[model samples]
Target: EELNMDLFSNCMDTVERCLRDAKMDKSSVHDIVLVGGSTRILKVQQLLKDLFNGKELCKSINPDEAVAYGAA
Candidate 1:
């Protein structure tokens, strides 16, 4: 729970910052990408969507296991 809360808090803070800088609301957010394995957690993904107001954050790319695959 602690981890989830932390991730959610940080993600929301970052999103708020970006939105402020870009003069955008959640609707203006083009894409929300997760760059690490920790993103695989359901809590993380759900929190992301919730924070963005059900914007359906993009996960077309890998969130947890794409780096090593490309590092090769």
Candidate 2:
């Protein structure tokens, strides 16, 4: 749990920075498309849910294949 908390903090920072750079608010985000293996972590998923106020994450694309899919 401690490790998860640390990761969550970092994720929060990154999200905040990205939102600020985009000049958008959390409410403006429609979907959270998680990519990469770390995103599959349950703790990460829970943290994101909390961050987004219970918004359902878009998991239609396989996390592992997201990069390849994007390149194609």
- Among the numbered candidates, top lDDT falls to 2
Give candidate 2 misplaced runs (Cα > 4 Å). none
User: What's the distance in Å from true for residue 37, model 1?
Assistant: 2.6
By summed lDDT, which 10 consecutive residues of candidate 2 come out lowest? 3-12
Per residue, candidate 1 scores C-alpha lDDT tens digits across 31-59 of 78777877877887787888877878668
Instruction: Report the lDDT tens digits of candidate 2 across residue range 31-71.
Output: 89999998998888888898899999989999999999989
lDDT of each: 0.76, 0.89
For model 1 the local lDDT of residue 57 reads: 64
TM-score of 2: 0.87
Candidate 1 CA-lDDT value: 0.76
